[model samples]
Target: MRIVVAPDSFGGTLSAREAAEAIAAGWRRAVPGDDVRIVPLADGGTGFAEVLHTALGGTVHTREVVGPLGDPVTGSWLEVDGTAYLECAAACGLHHVGRADRVPGAARSATSYGVGQLLADARSAGVRRIVVGLGGSATTDGGAGMLAALGLVPVDEDGLELPYGGAALATCARLDGDADLGGIEIVAASDVDNPLLGPHGAAAVFGPQKGADDAAVAELDAALGVFAGVLATFAGREVRDEAAAGAAGGLGAALLALGAGVVSGAGLVRELVGLDTELDAAAAGGGPAITGEGSFDWQSLRGKLITAVARGAADRGIPCVVLAGQVSVGRREAAAAGVDSAHGVADEFGLEASMADPAGTLAELAATVAPRWGR
Candidate 1:
């Protein structure tokens, strides 16, 4: 019998690669001759570079760029499959900031200059399609810093270069586009559909998670609103209303200002990993396939990555089991998503205990299900 074990990152506990290895180890102990393939995957958020490199055979390019606090940090992205994948978090993620430094007003000074630097490298290399994995963002400057790096000049009232940060958007009076994006197909792979400036906007929704207080969130929201108005003034279009404008700290809107379109982040990951073909092969092999993420919530039923994975398995007539660190989704909802089983690792045990001794737990689960499938 053949089995494919594809798992995503368990957030702070285990990487997708590590999780796959642990599960494979358990299976090896249980059924020694079972054909098992390990594919470490990500949904275009935290482990985006690793997943793209695994799926597309890419090269990592690192550079020193501005962090969320304007500090110099080494950030990296990938260039492969005729495209580059960039996630702002590698260099300027919220995790980089200390709990004390979690001041939203101060964190607003975060700059996505590194993200632009990645795009610049892709463009300079004559790369055509660039899929930006938009997640785990720290800066909430409405992507102005990223755009500024890409040659969108933000001028102060006196037409001087406005300092990087959403707070400076209040002074953004003029905008000019002179970036040399000669041959770049930018795709904004976004996970959220929040508008640019509203209750569900970047600041209002995701700000608190990133350490923003009520007042600071409003301030950031207002600043992003200003950035949107200025950008719309030049683009002659409403940037705030864009479906994914709130993604990546409103960097989605920044990319939109540059003529990029938003697609499901999971869709991009699925295509990169050849999920459709993988599912077909899994069905033919008569083996069960599993894929999951850190959490399975209502969002998964949307265009989230796990749903796409489940959809691929369903299309191939394979029973796909979704094993996550935590599951808050309902049966009716998950059934509609075509997930045959929704198992929560958290429900079984704490993440640290479960992953620290993953082999035993995996073996137990496998043995329990082994008889049913004649393992």
Candidate 2:
């Protein structure tokens, strides 16, 4: 028998690769003869580089880049088969903010300039294809910060450059001096397709999640609206609230302006790692496919990686099981996302005990379920 092991990162407890390995070990112990394929997944978030690296046998490159708060932080990228996989969180992740510094007014200083630097490096390396994964960012500049870093100049009425952040967009008079981005293809990786402006826009819908207060959210929304207006004058089309414009603090809007294509984060990762093919091969050999994530909330079924896995497996007529760190939905909700069954790792053990021995507990759980797979 064959079994496909694909799961997302278990948040702080374990990475997707580690969790998959531990689960596979347990499944092996329980069902000795079963052929298992481990396919760890990510939605372009914190653990994206490592997960993609493991899946594609790619190389991970580390570099020092300006963080969300302008401090130097270690950033990373995945180079697989000559394609650069850029994770926005590596440079502008909200996790970089300290609990003490978790103030919305302060986070307003955060920008995605570091991501522009990463893209510059990738361009310098002569990479033809670049895929940017957008998640866990700590900025709301509508990608203006990133654009400025890539050599685009945003100046005010008096002909002085403005500071990076969404708050200053209202003062932007003209966008000057384009960059030398020649023949570069950028694919935006995001799950949410919200527009860049308005009530449901970036600042309104997501600013609070990044610690912004109501007033701050309103200000950012206005700023982004102005920025979109300026961009429309240049691009000759209104990009306000364009699909995926709100991804990564309006990073999507910026990329959209630069003519980058956008796709589902889960779909991109799956195709990049050949995950669906692996699952298909496993199902052909007669075994169920397993997939999951750190937490299974309502959004889990809303175009996330775990749901993507279940859909792919189900398309092949294979039953898919899920093992999450925490499962918040019922069977109906799970099935709505094509999940046959879903269970949390915490359900099998005490929360404290599980946290202490996550790898062991995960392995043991997989081993317990191995025999049911006809192994």
Candidate 3:
């Protein structure tokens, strides 16, 4: 029997690569004669660059850049066949700042300067194309900090450069376009589709999760409006309502201003990893494909990595089994979402224990569920 194991990162627990290895290891333990393939996946989030590097051979370049809170941090990007792959979370993710250290002031001052620094570095690498994975960002500066790092600084009424973070956007007068992207192609890969402004905008919806209070959310929204107005003047068109413009705290909006193509992260990753080809091969051999993430919920069914994997498996006439940390939906729901089988490690091991050692627990759960697959 041939089996494919593909999984996204389990939040704070295991990385996608680690999860795939653990699942493959356990599946083999249950059926030693069965062949298993490990394929890790990402949704243009924290592990985007790593998964792409693993799927396609690449040269990783590391650079020290500013963190979300203006601290020095090391970041990396991948170069594959003259194309650069960069993950925003590598520089501005919430993981860099501990929960205990995430004060309101820190949230208010966080910037995406490091992401901008990384883009510049990628451009300097002489890559013909750059794909930015916009997810897990910690700032809400509307990508102003990134622009600043790229030499496109925004100035206030007094002509002094504005401070870092979303708070400073309220006083932004105009953008200074001193930087040039040359002739490089820029693409933004993201899973979100929210516009840049209004009730469903970046600040109103994602601000609280990043530590903004009601007053702060309102302020950030207003500041983003001001920023949008200034940006519209330069873009020669209104971009405030464009889809995906709210992703990664408005980093997607910045990419739009640069005339970058916004694409679905799941779709891009699936093609890059050759998921469909693998699924077709597995189906021809009458094998099933296993996929999972931290949680299998409504969000998972809504065009996430697991959803794409399941669809690909279905198209190839292969059963898709899901092994998640927690399964919030029922068996019927899972089937309706194209998942043939669903199992939650938390259901068997309890939430605390499952989260404590997710890789090991996931391995154990895979073995328990192995009998139902690859007869």
Candidate 4:
């Protein structure tokens, strides 16, 4: 039997590529004669650029850029087929900030300026199109820092530039200067469809995840509202309420202001990896496609990488299985989402053991599940 193993990163424990490889190894171990194929995926977050580069055979360019907290950090982008793929997380992702440091001060000061620098770099390369993977960011500045980096400086009443951070945007009276992208086609690859401001907007929904308290969330939201107003005037249109405008902490709004289009991050990754075609081929051979992430919860059902993979398998009439770090999603919900079976490393092995050896425990779980599914 042929088994297709595809998984997103196991939280921060393993990368998508590593998770796929481990699953494939365990499946092969369970049944050496069975053929196993590995396909890794991302949803425009942590592993976005690496996963795309692996599938597209691109050149990865690395540069030193400002991180979320105004520190210098190494960042990279993928250039493939004259299209540059930029992952926003590489510049201002929450991963860059330590958990202990994720207090209100850090949350209020995070900036997306590094992402704009990357966009500038891509534009300098003369790429006709640029796809920005927008998620896992740490800022709620309404992309003010990004716009600032791109020459749309946010200024106070005194016409002085505002300091970096969402809180600083509260004092923003207007924007000085304009962004010049040279007319390059920009695409914002995102998973969430939240708008830029409101109850379901960036700060209200994602601020806490980046370490904002109740007060910080309120402050950031109000500040983002001010930033959005100024940006609407600058762009001659309103993008604050557009779908995905809240992604990457209002980076989506900034991109929209620059005439960027939005696309499903998971869908784009699946297409770039040819996951549907692979599922079609696997279906012909009668095999179950396995996909997973760190935690299989309610969030996984809402257009995440695993959901995209399961949908692809379902379309091809193939069974889809999941082997995740933990499984909090109910079986009924899993079935509704086109997942046939779900296994958890933490359930099989204790949480301590699973967290200690994510790859090994995941491989063990895959090996255990293989005989039942691989048969």
lDDT of each: 0.75, 0.82, 0.86, 0.89
Give me the runs in candidate 2 sitting further than 4 Å from their true place.
Answer: 29-33, 57-60, 80-82, 198-200, 347-357, 364-375
Ranking of predictions according to TM-score: 4, 3, 2, 1
* Clashes within 3 Å, all models in order: 1, 4, 0, 0
Give the winner by lDDT.
4
Candidate 4 stretches greater than 4 Å from native: none
| Residue 32 alpha-carbon offset, candidate 2, angstroms | 4.2
The 10-residue segment with the lowest total lDDT in model 4: 298-307
Write the residue-wise lDDT of candidate 4 on 204-299 in tens digits. Answer: 888998899999999999999998888788779999999889988998998898889999899999999988777877888787999999889986
lDDT of 3 at 260: 82
Judged by TM-score relative to the true structure, which candidate is superior, 1 or 3? 3
lDDT of 3 by residue, 309-362 (tens): 888888888899999999998888889878998889999899998978888999
Instruction: List the candidates' TM-scores in order.
Output: 0.88, 0.89, 0.93, 0.96
Better of 1 and 4 by TM-score: 4
Better of 2 and 3 by lDDT: 3
Tens digits of per-residue lDDT for model 1, 310-335: 87787778887777767899888898
Q: What is the lDDT of candidate 4?
A: 0.89
Clashing pairs in 2: 26-367, 193-244, 195-241, 196-241
